[model samples]
Target: MTVAIVGDIGGTHARFAVWRDNGLEQIEVLATADYSSPESALAAYCERAGLSLGAGSAVCLACAGPVSDGDFQFTNNHWRINRAAFCRALHIERLLLINDFAATALGVTLLEPNERLAVRAGHAQADRPVVVIGPGTGLGAANLLPKGAGEWQALPGEGGHVDLPIGSESEAELWLLLHRQFGAVQAEDVLSGAGLLALYAVVCQRNGQPAQHANAAQICAAALQGESLATNALEQFCVWLGRVAGNHALSLGARGGVYIVGGMVPKFADFFVRSGFAAAFADKGAMGDYLADVPVWLVTAPYPGLLGAGVALQQAG
Candidate 1:
């Protein structure tokens, strides 16, 4: 049997698995920092799985940031992929590359009911577009369009870099602060892991309080413990996330639904469910009613990207 390999490479980790019998096996995760390049990491994975690469093997990689034909650079990491060189080194018959969020969007199509938790209740319109957005090392967004007969197309985009929207006077004030600090503030500037920490510090500065948390995890811990500043920052984070997601939904007319997939939101699922996200999502002045009927789901699947890369590989074949 021919061997197929799929990978989901992010800023921090690279997840690899073998595609066999239409499912993933021998799944392994390696820290990106542990290896100098993806080729090295994949070599380690193959060693652990007792496999060899040759002309009979095929590989698909879901990578962070925009993908192109020749060479690619990761948005949040130092790794670079020279497509032709990689294939030459691996001696693979075929290699496919796609944006990571595009893979996540494809993964949404393969989700089971239990893999997702509903954040809003509404009916999803069949055949309409679906929006996939998430926050991790960076913010990512994509759209999934159903093409009928069980086929779907995933559209990748840099939606995370769009201008941050302001909904209220307080948010406007915050925007000014952010602009002063970072010049031009994009959604990713305040919606990512590092952004969360920055938001916490800015919130403290805005309120004349001393910032206590140094990272996103610490801020989340403080919020769950009912620390005032931490709670406020987290709330703002969810609200901004909702605002950005709503913008994407509006841009794409995503009546099929919105799937939130990432490492950040799931960590505070309860708080997110109760936060200002819902109100902010549907807060568009006139389009509020339209957005209210659009359902939103938080993806809880552990390896959506890897699964999606396998799906992409199958689709290519």
Candidate 2:
């Protein structure tokens, strides 16, 4: 039987799986820090799965950051991929690479109803574009366009690097603080995992208090425990995320709805649901009504990137 390998490589973790019989098997997630390179990680996964790759086998990797010229470097990780070297080392017949968010957009199509949590109630227009945005080690964005029948196209870009939007006078003050620290503030600077911690510090600074939490997880835990500083930072995070997502929705006219998929938001799903996200999303003055009906959902499915990698492989074949 001809089999393939599919992977989703992010900044911290690299997930691998075997593609056979139209499904993924032997799925494994490895820490990127544990391996020197992606090839090493794959070899480790292959050993654990007791599989071997050869001339007829193929590989598809959904990687974070831009993919180009058969080679790419990850945005938030140190590992890099040279397509020629990777193919030669594994003896694979073919290799396909795609932006991680593009794979995410494709994966959104495969989500079951139960795998997503609705944030806003609205009707999704048939055949209209769908927006996908998420924050992990970095922020990622993509658009899914229907091509009739059941096919879709995923367009990925670095929407995360866009300038941070200030929606209030207080937000302008916080932006100035962030700008002073980072030179220029981008959405990713305040919407990602690290961004969460950074925002927490800024909140503490604004209140003239010492920041007690050291990491995003710590801050989230504190927020859940009713810590005022942490709560404020997390709430602001959700509001900013909603604003950025709304911008993307407007830019693409994504009336088909928006899917929020990422490691960060899922961590604080409960708080995010009740936070200022929905209000901020629909707060656009002239376009408030236009965005009011644009639905949004938070994806909770496991291994979506891997699933999308498999989908991309099938599409290529």
Candidate 3:
């Protein structure tokens, strides 16, 4: 197709779209398991849309897991997308493989000013770096570095695997609990979707509650509906999310700000905004004051990856 093909490939699913006039169209959600490779899924999207992809088409994919060189192989899904191979299969002339976290970071430009609700109300320097840390199927982290006036570069990162911060007694106990499972517990060890389920299992085990083997959605729903164990786990999740965001901000010196993205937190946006996120983010030891001055924003755009993919394709030319 003459039009651009863009996709945000997550651990579990892939969101694909075509863009025009700074807006996303023909958005489709497809199961990564439904196809053996990214190209098959792309072909299905085109067939379903009744559109034809011309040879020498252009494409971009913001993928889950890490991105290096020109390929992006999904972590959870069994798909390895090489730039050259992918370009050939899809008949794409040019393709940009972007890390999902980097895609979220790219949203700093697309995000409206009003969407950036000030959680800290700090004196932000426009040119200062900004951070993006989101917890979904896994933890995604990145930053936005200013290039020039009205221009910024989204830098991919893997800070999610860093050591987890031990704070409260409950948190300490959880760390010990996780140590028995995974040899070394990282920040994402207890922050991602599976992490939430792990936390809930620990809580259930400790309290002698029946081990309810539920998915992330069920756990979230039960928590929202007033299940004690699920509710407490959700609360702990919020606190930890805040602490992680704070740690990222301090490490990056993100005086421009920090943003929260991904699909997991959107459901609990109200609680997250009014939750311990702000407190935990500002709860650093010696740098508490400094971190307090850093602003934080929750990315509210639904199709940020679509815009980001366009940005990457534009930059590639």
List RMSD in Å for every model shown: 1.3, 1.2, 2.0
**Per-residue lDDT for 168-249 in model 2, tens only?**
9999989988988899899999999999988999999999999998899999999999999999999999999999999999
Residues 1-317 of candidate 1: C-alpha lDDT, one tens digit per residue: 34589999988889999987668889999999999999899888988888876523889899999998868899888899887788888888688999999999998888999999999888899889999999999999999999999788999999999999999999998889899989999999999999998888889989999998789999999999999999999999999999999999998999999999888999999999999998999999998988988999999999999889988988887
lDDT of 3 by residue, 135-201 (tens): 8888889888999868789888788888888779988887788888887988887789998898888
Pairs clashing within candidate 1: none
Residue 293, model 2, lDDT = 88
Model 2 segments more than 4 A misplaced: none
Candidate 3 stretches with Cα past 4 Å from truth are: 113-120
Model 3: lDDT equals: 0.81
TM-score of each: 0.97, 0.98, 0.94
Candidate 3 has a TM-score of: 0.94
Candidate 2 local Cα displacement, residue 303, angstroms = 1.2
Rank list by lDDT: 1, 2, 3
> What is the lDDT, from 0 to 100, of the residue 225 in candidate 1?
90
Model 1 regions more than 4 Å off: none
Cα shift from native, residue 222, model 3 (Å): 1.6
Q: Which candidate, 2 or 3, has the higher TM-score?
A: 2
